[model samples]
Target: MARIMSGVQPTGNLHIGNYLGALVNWVRLQDQYEAYFSIVDLHALTGRPEPAALRHAVREVAIGVLASGVDPERATVFVQSHVPQHTELAWVLTCLTPLGDLNRMTQFKDKSQHQPDNINTGLFTYPVLQTADIVLYRADRVPVGEDQEQHLELARETVRRFNHVYGETFPEPQVVKSSAPRVMGLDGESKMSKSRNNEIGLFETADETMLKLRGAKTDPARLRKTDKGTPEVCNIYSYHGFFTGEVQRAAIATGCRSAQLGCVDCKKLLAQNLEVVKGPIRERAAVLREQPRRLEEILAAGAHRARAEAEKTMVLVRERVGLGAPRS
Candidate 1:
């Protein structure tokens, strides 16, 4: 099976957008690929999160990953920082990466504007590290959302540059696009994000989920129960496309257009469907949280497996780049 690599930042609680966009697909693809799913704690450092918070978030995100059905038996679930080769390889790639290319990255520009006071070098060279993350594993396929397409392209270019200079050290990784690539937040203005405060947490209780849904944006034209509305324009309905079945989705759309169903009812239905998926995941996460030692053991085992593979790549990288002998 071809190897695939992907990761989620250990920033905060993952939400439904994460589930629909990445985690769900990770679960599906694990059996078909040599999957390496990582909780990228190193990448999360750009925000300068508190150390204690970061440690807690890492375990929480790992629980979310495991609870979402990414089996440790079938996939390598590791923390990014645990495998030091990631940053080591990142530095090598950063040297080869063009400043112009990094400057052109929209994400870097956007992030710089968002955190103007802390426009650190890491923020600018983020894509270089991402390239290292994929190529270090020699992952042939990378599952990414629409927002990361530019970064993936940059990764491909960086790989090409490395190959040209170093002579075929890595294969260009391909994109594995998520079915729901851009899950909009409840606000319907931007992508679902914790920073935006428009997300429904994956581990939230059913009542909490429903409360958030109640305030979610729907068809703007929808004024009263009697007014007809377009489901296509409604963010809630779009969410229904992911969580609700085809038959029910069609019925909801028809009800929406015909003025038979109110936005409140529609949101309630979505909340119910969402619970069907998130409830079990929340329960499993609870169990994992109660057993912190078990979570650590899984991560330790995964890091051991990941380190073995990373060292193999680094040995070749060191020889190709004329680095010093392997450390004792």
Candidate 2:
């Protein structure tokens, strides 16, 4: 099986956007590929999160990943910092990466604008580290959202540059696009993110989820209960496309267009469908949280597996780049 690698940052609680956009796909892909999924704690550092909060977030994100059905036995699941070779390889790749490429990255520009006071080198070179994260595993494919397409392209370019200079040391990883590539937040104007406070947490109780849904933005054209709504323009309807069945989604769409389903009723239906998926995940996460030792063991085992693979790649990289002592 071709190897695929992907990761989630331990920045905040995993949300429904995460579930539909990434984690759900990760669960399905595990059986078809040699999968490596990491809680990328190193990447999370750019946000300058509090030390204790970061540690707590990492554990919580691990629970979220495991509870979402990413089996440890099927996929190598580890913390990114646990294997030092990621940053080690990142430095090597960073040297090969062009400054112009980093400058052109829209994400870097957006992030810089978001945190102008803290525009550090790490923020600028984020893509280079991401390139290292994938190629360090010699991952043949990477599951990426629409937002990361540019970064993946850069990864491919960096790999090609390394190959041109040092021979074919790594494969150019291909993209495995998610089914729901860009899940909009409840605001319906931007991507779902914890920073925006527009996300519904994956582990939230049914009541909590429903409360958020109640205030979610729908079609602006929808003026009242009897007004016909456009499901295509409604973020809630987009959500139904992911969580709700085809038959029900079609019914919902018809109901929406016909003014039969009010926004409140529509949101309630979405809340119910969401619970069908998240309820089990939340329960599983609770069990994992109660057993912190078990979570550590899984992460440790995964790191051991990941480190072994990373070392193999580094050995070749060292030899190719003439980094280590001369071979006798």
lDDT of each: 0.92, 0.93
Specify the highest-TM-score model's number. Answer: 1
Pairs that collide in candidate 1 are none
Most accurate candidate by lDDT:
2
- Give the per-residue lDDT of model 1 (tens digit) for 148-174: 999999999999998899889998999
**lDDT of candidate model 2 versus the reference:** 0.93
Worst 10 residues of 2 by lDDT: 319-328
Provide TM-scores for the models: 0.98, 0.98
Q: Show model 2 residue runs off by greater than 4 Å.
A: 325-328
Candidate 2, position 145, lDDT:
95
Query: How far out, in Å, is residue 252 in model 1?
Result: 1.0
> Residue 51 of model 1: what lDDT?
100
**Candidate 2: TM-score?**
0.98
